[model samples]
Target: MECERKYRSRALYKACMRAFDTLPVCALVDSRFLCMHGGLSPNIRIISDIEKLDRFVETPDSGPLCDLLWSDPSENFDDIDDQQPEFKPNNVRGCAHFFSYYACRDFLLRNNLVSIIRGHEVQKNGVRFFRKSSRTKFPVLISLFSAPNYCDTYNNIAAILKIDDHQQLSVVNIEAHAHPFVLPNFENGFQFGERFVLYHVTNLLLSIFNMYSPEELAAEDGRHDKTGVELLNKKRLIGTMDRAYAELKKINKITLNLRGLTPSYSAYKELLTRPEIKALVNEAEKGRITSFDQAIQLDHIFERRPHT
Candidate 1:
């Protein structure tokens, strides 16, 4: 049973990876601005260069795809006024080069791009604008990072960039909301699935129900409960499956963060050896129980139990 579960998990991971192939490497807006997740690469000299690359496979470690996903801007290299091409190795990140202003300018001119907007590194102010040089008037590059109070450590402000009809750029900073000091156990797969995953599962159910006409749904009212959602019509179920797939396509990535230190490999390995966790996972899977509602009811029952 364990082996079967592991095999299924591996298959699901592969399917998720293949889905990434359909995502665009970069998006051009209004034929003037280029938007991407990371900075420029030496191989990607022109905008057309990105169009030529195959995005069907996983990003290579030392190629254009890797550079686009991993690169960061270097403040140290921007001190000089000379427009000579330069490259700075980012020993901190251990991947992708730290690009210079001259490099940004060359890429912009070559591609006829007005600005390059990217998000890779976090900023305290949530946004940073980089010009071609200290004397330059217009911004050649913009960096944005919107998750404030990142990792529950930094007291940073998040910002949103908005462009008006006249092409004027503006930013709105958002204050971070207070969260519990002892955050939810995001590391626990079972608990995480119960909290976040099940919410989406319920949405999938409702999105399925959204397909049927009110008249059709009302016809089964006598058979269904007062909520009128008990009866599972085959046609509606099929429509739900199609809609669920469409919803899956809309997701790009999921980022998980550990609030503090991660457990050592030996400690984590020891955790897997525990029999109770295994039993819990096995029982949960076998029952097809991914419902948060069930967990809430169990919690309420536990609360009502008399203390020893």
Candidate 2:
């Protein structure tokens, strides 16, 4: 509600909500394929069973409705045998069940359906086909993801499923097109203004501090001698400040490069674990690697070398 008030009109928000209210949770196409946002529910054995669900209210935390919205196809479908149960608790998601190949096969056979089409998981090629068995003529389940370059980081292809009158399925793949870059986290005008003010204020204070000469600083310290130990100490302090400023600039550049290359904090930490990256970090700490470009070149050299 806060986000809607900030960026969208109340009327538009209401219209969108009304449209969602009318949309069906699942669809049967050509009386052969079942299409839904997520996979099947353990409680729903037939198509009529889904039709009888009370979907008008908010989806409950657990039950047939929640499972229909949140359940996923099991990753170990190939390993599942005929004797194993069709559905198991989804440990990864912690709410719904994981439907295996056997479950999907049983559902299709029970409903007199050819295939189940769902869109709960992202696919690298935008589509995935799961066969019921090694000798099955057609895939029992088809997972289609129409978002290319998902989250602007996965570099995945988008695809659409085309079902002809004969019930034959074909996939059309699409590559991500170039688009204008935007800052992450949907930064608002107020946030940008705050950052601008803080940056300038910090720079202004640093400039004022740097304006003081060594002699002036020593004088301010109540040391009147021009060539005394106080003057030497002040000189050393100035040199230390210069070194610190240089190091800060280098760190800022590296941080920008890392942000551009790594999409998330987990990925950044994983990159740090690489031997080349670790070596670069050690050099950076010792003030040896001064630029991100130098670090990139060293990383490339490590990439080209064969592993022992």
Candidate 3:
């Protein structure tokens, strides 16, 4: 009733049908970091199940959830609930069960997986992460999107996590995309369809460009002193996605000297590389994610953000 009035679409029937059909299965993924629409196109890989739901927020039969969103997440997380209203909703609304993560946190203390990571909310200025429990300090939030021009408001983006050879969970909330092959200063940010296409276009092109033999790579330089110019350009394009890849491959990295998250590297890799990741990102980009998938979605938002 409200959405139709606000957006003036009589397609509620069509929309509702779409939501019920898809969301139930998309919330079960395990990811260290997530973004609304960052994962799309062919080159970018997005993890689907780790509860990356940007579209499922409820109407509350009220105004937007009164819970607070951080303005300077890193600097002000302790004040999360400070500015929040008396009424707030638990913003998590995807397939990844908040209760399940609660279960996993305690389980990791005895089992293998250590921390759970998720990202898909407003962390004003782009970054704003939190650790679930100090008792265990296991489940954590790691996100990045600092300096995103894509957003009209000043947005700060960030990311989390890294792994060593021993397969331990090390979370890192970075300020920007991890660009190894591009320039330090460049413009980029959140985009849906066509922008996503360019992202993958640039990514695949770079991958293929890097695949060329040393002589072939030198051929480009032979024509112009682009070695310096080209490397920076590549990083500008591959920057964020590069970071996403590094942290994602820990479970299955065989030659990279990186830690293995799960003993079964092949399975881990297969899960990580699934096309569903991009699908999930696309879902978020379109605001199609919803809680209809859940028997009961997480619906409680504490008035105050914690300080632990």
Candidate 4:
């Protein structure tokens, strides 16, 4: 029975992967709008370029297929003074490259596409429209993330894009509904009740013992001189733990904000070398920067620098 179950699971996994392999990497809507999971790839100049990729195999680490599925639109593309390139390394994703607005525009112009629709990032709103320039009638790119209240923490609305026969596009936003809370790891009610009772009883006994213990009384009398310092240190430790917990929550938030945004431990160490990010960390340590959103902004860190 066990061997049969294992074989069935493997077969199911392969079947799912095969289904994924059959899907197109991109689509053209009415010969106007190009749709993909991620933004443009530098290697793909025309629609036929995407068609040439072998979709039957597993996705590669780096290539046109990888870029089409992993790339993102550069945040600094609109900065005229920066003169950013059409494509640059995507440090956030650790693979593929961030495509600039100009790159997307050129691709759309070359392919006779009016706009590009993609979904790889979470937006506060369900949809985000890229900046429009004089050369295009519509926003160059539209990002639509359909997962509502993403991962149950983002509290972000979800949306779906609708296209009618006339090729008119409309977005429908959705709010998340409340669901029953389940204990972590699906712990059962009886086990939870037992643990709760044991915890309170143990704490109560410990408190009573501390109140009456002969050793504790002796220490309280003898340690009067160090009491103030010890209390101050305890307060400091508590403050430190609270700050650490808050920062931990923020880290979780940032890591889940979008796909491929999570930095490795090595990346964090490397970022500390930058003076700007270092200053922000210092401010956070001093409590000047209370919110993670304000303290850590990745856009400036990952901004494209012009070639010297």
- The best candidate in terms of lDDT: 4
What does candidate 4's lDDT look like per residue over 1-308, in tens digits? 22234454766777777999999888888777888998889999999988899988877778899889888999776565337789998877777789998898888889888889999877768899887756766888899999876545456789998889887889999998988754323435575455445545545544554454444543565674576456445445545555555554444334433223234546656767988776665554443333324423533454222220
Q: Tens-digit lDDT track for model 3 on 1-308?
A: 44454456768756886675454322222433222221111111233322343435531221212111221113232342334332222233211112222332333343333343334343444444454655655433344443432122122334444556775645444443333431111112232133445555656766775776545654665754568457556655575665555444321122121111112334435433556543433343343223222101111111123321
lDDT of each: 0.61, 0.68, 0.35, 0.68
Please write out the lDDT profile of model 2 over residues 1-308, one tens digit for every residue: 53465566788777777778678989998888899987888899998998898887766767888788778888777664677778888765566788988888888888888888899776778999886644356788888999886545456689998878787778999998988654433435475355445555555655665687755765665766754456556556655655555544444444433322322335445656778766765564454443435544433422211221
- Which residue pairs come into collision in candidate 1? none
Those runs of model 3 whose alpha carbons end farther than 4 Å from true positions after fitting are: 1-21, 24-112, 132-139, 143-151, 158-308
lDDT of 2 at 253: 41
Q: How high a TM-score does candidate 1 get?
A: 0.55
RMSD of candidates 1 onward, in order = 20.3, 9.9, 22.2, 9.1
Q: CA lDDT of 191 in candidate 1?
A: 52
For candidate 3, the C-alpha RMSD (Å) to the true structure equals 22.2
Model 1 per-residue lDDT tens digits across residues 186-282: 3334654454554466566767776777656766746555445544454466556556544432211111222321123344344336675334333
Best by TM-score: 2
Off by over 4 Å in 4: 1-14, 180-205, 208-308
User: Which ranking of candidates, highest lDDT first?
Assistant: 4, 2, 1, 3
